[model samples]
Target: MMRHPFVLFALGTFAVFLLLHLAGGRQYVGVLSGTVVGGAGGAGLGLLYALAWFGAVLAAPVLLLAGLLDGALARASRARP
Candidate 1:
């Protein structure tokens, strides 16, 4: 399971997002809403946070599904004697 590339990618994406979120990335995300929590310097941080967030939201699910399909195909192939 862990050997699957898609799964690894999804997990990695989620982990990065989790780390950023834990480190107060949420505050920076307000930049998107015109809040500007930390001024100009924060804009970059907010962008990073936003990218990670979007990746986790958009790519993660597709990666997970690809991983699942890959795993299932591998299993099916192995079962064919």
Candidate 2:
């Protein structure tokens, strides 16, 4: 849903993983693979997975804050009469 920014970020990260896998199996193929950074690419996935995980974790709080703010605004407006 449009209200869930974390989901969008997660999907985007997954898309990146797919792209990396398509480009070639890790092994410092380029700046795109996590192997280039000396990470979990040994299994053909590292950077992209970590990125998606962190992005979602971080975005969850932001999404929650936005929801809280919107709810507060609605309640405040209703009390104005």
Candidate 3:
């Protein structure tokens, strides 16, 4: 929902993460920079790894926070009337 922008962003990032993994980016994910060198495929894999890492580390937290905020807002609204 537009009201919960973070929830949407997190969900979108998570979907991208899943897509990266499904595209055979698992081995490439969580790897250090310069670990794999050479070719266009290598470059693509590196990008995928970066995206997946962000999705896991960044989006997950945002999603949790969004849920917490949504719940708190719900409670506050309910208490008002």
Candidate 4:
């Protein structure tokens, strides 16, 4: 059975969370301006922030273009003699 895109995205997100949690458990800290803090938390937070920013900035245009391309391809296929 084909899984939905959102479902796949959720699974991928969960897997990344699990991997990050297991790898270090947030003991280490990421360095910024020679300061130390929770590494996993900092990295995870940054990654999530970046993903959210990118989704906001690019998701709509990308999806719209994908839909238009799919529609065009579908039309071309149907036009085939």
TM-score of each: 0.86, 0.39, 0.64, 0.36
In the order shown, the candidates' Cα RMSDs to the true structure are 1.4, 7.2, 3.2, 7.2
Model 4 TM-score relative to the real fold: 0.36
Range of the 10 consecutive residues with the lowest summed lDDT in candidate 4: 25-34
Which residue pairs in candidate 3 collide?
Answer: none
Question: 2 or 3, which is superior by lDDT?
Answer: 3
lDDT of 2 by residue, 1-81 (tens): 344454454566556655665654444444353335544453435444444445545654575667666667777999998
Q: What is the per-residue lDDT of model 3 for residues 1-81, given as tens digits with 9 covering 90 to 100? A: 344667677767787777877877766643455566545676678677687778778777778687769878987999996
* TM-score ranking, high to low: 1, 3, 2, 4
lDDT of 2: 0.54
- Displacement of residue 18 (Cα, Å) in model 1 is 0.3
TM-score of 3: 0.64
- Lowest summed lDDT across 10 adjacent residues in model 3 is found at 29-38
Please list the C-alpha lDDT of all candidates, in the order they appear.
0.88, 0.54, 0.71, 0.52
Model 3 CA lDDT for position 6: 70
1-81 per-residue lDDT for model 1 (tens digits):
357989999999999999988888778877888888888878778878899999999999999999989899999999999
Residue 75's lDDT within candidate 1 is 92
Tens digit per residue, CA lDDT, model 4, 1-81: 224454355445556555555665334333323344555666555455445445534564465556566667777999999
The better candidate by TM-score, 1 or 3, is 1
